[model samples]
Target: MTSKLTLSVFTAPSRPVNGPPAIPAPQGGWTWPPTAATLIAGEREAILVDTVPTVEDSRKLADWIEASGKELTTIYITHGHIDHYLGSSTLVDRFPRARLVATEAVARDIKTEAESGNDRDFYGQMFVDELCSTVIEPEVLADHRLELEGHDVIAVATGQSDVKDSSYIHVPDLSAVIVGDIAYNDVHPTLIGSDHESRLAWIQTLSQIQDLKPSIVVAAHRRSDATNNAEVLADTIAYLQKVDRFLPGNRLQCSSLSR
Candidate 1:
């Protein structure tokens, strides 16, 4: 008989940014908020959703995965965000057998980010010694579906959330969707670069996620202690909807929306 699947989340707490604030925040600088990686395990093997960013954080994540005593067979990246996949090299080193995979578009975006000098400077300046300088791009997933101990783990590419070619992981067995930046849980979302069209697209994406009827929704960035409540999907949609409606009238007021 096939073994039952178990899901667990490990979160790395927010850090104080070093560079100029992306938006107005406390004088101490904005806290980056926590990012979580979900591990889905069966009796013999496991699949990891995302890896934490920094070298230190990824090492800690590796230790946590090791503690599960399950062999990691796959590392699935939900999107191209550096914060989501920057420590991929560290994970790959720790789990040499685990293959890293992502959607074709996300793979391309990741490659682009890895090669971009501006991104290097930007993230390097923001994170300083805490960031992982090594970049590793995941292989393109052929069918957008992953197999974990006879279970199907589907990856759906949503057009945009906070970035282009974004996606989420849908594990039907657990009724869980690990949304990468598509939804925020009690944390300020990054929207400084977003426009009217993009916000509408984001709302549509959230609506699509809601349609899936996932009972457990995990936000990529959230409070470390927050629960994986499905309501965060609706909450994100409402936030985006409000941004769409009010952003035009008052730029300053809308800036605070992200806060």
Candidate 2:
């Protein structure tokens, strides 16, 4: 199968690219060090999967987008994590014409996180302290499929899984799916602010993705893997089941208790 997206790992201080692998935390070790967002450019227009955690990282993505020369028509926010959405402002600054596409739930989550004063600290830790103030509000709320650049992109909501307001962006034409934190390649999946239902939703979402028969799957957090959709779906389901089994109970524990 032809690869629809290419993944690149950006350099960071805490998560240096060439340094020794970061040791995982005792309970939930750092599965994968946070990297700048993924950029998805097609024949007609460019679509940024998720913005990085800092202005500098976002700038890198913006620079690539500008170099590509294709019109950056949309910025797809896969979830509400600060790392995914905070760098959106940098992209907006560069591509003023690009529409910020996100679900209404994500918009509400961003607003709530900003108002709660947790956003600052979240970005401050993932990125640098200087970019803690950068926040971009969504300009478009997409609850369903939207046609753009000859592709019918559907925004499937998988909320409260790895993050609140999580979503999966599927491009049927390309036979590809941009799975946010729902599935990670070679890394322990993040489980923050989630519940049993959310975990089940995440698994169900992966099942739905498998049904899409995507030729390529772009995981928001890891390097893109050239594997069948079923393999990716099975891996995600197994990971979630692992978490479920590790908990040692009939009722899967909540995100808080799991931690």
Ten consecutive residues with minimal summed lDDT in candidate 2? 11-20
Clashes of each: 0, 2
Model 1 deviation from native, Cα RMSD in Å:
2.5
Q: Estimate, for each residue in 1-259, the C-alpha lDDT of model 1 and write its tens digit.
A: 4788889999988776654545556755555678889998999999999888877889999999999999999999988888898888898999999999999998998899878855767877766447877778899998999988889889998898988679999999999999989999988777767878788888889999999898999998888788897899999988887876877533232333222
Report the Cα lDDT for candidate 2: 0.64
Tell me the TM-score of each prediction against the true structure.
Answer: 0.92, 0.77
Off by over 4 Å in 1: 19-28, 249-259
lDDT of 2 by residue, 123-181 (tens): 45543234636666785564566556555677887754576457877777667777877
lDDT for every model?
Answer: 0.84, 0.64
Candidate 2: residue pairs that collide: 24-29, 25-29
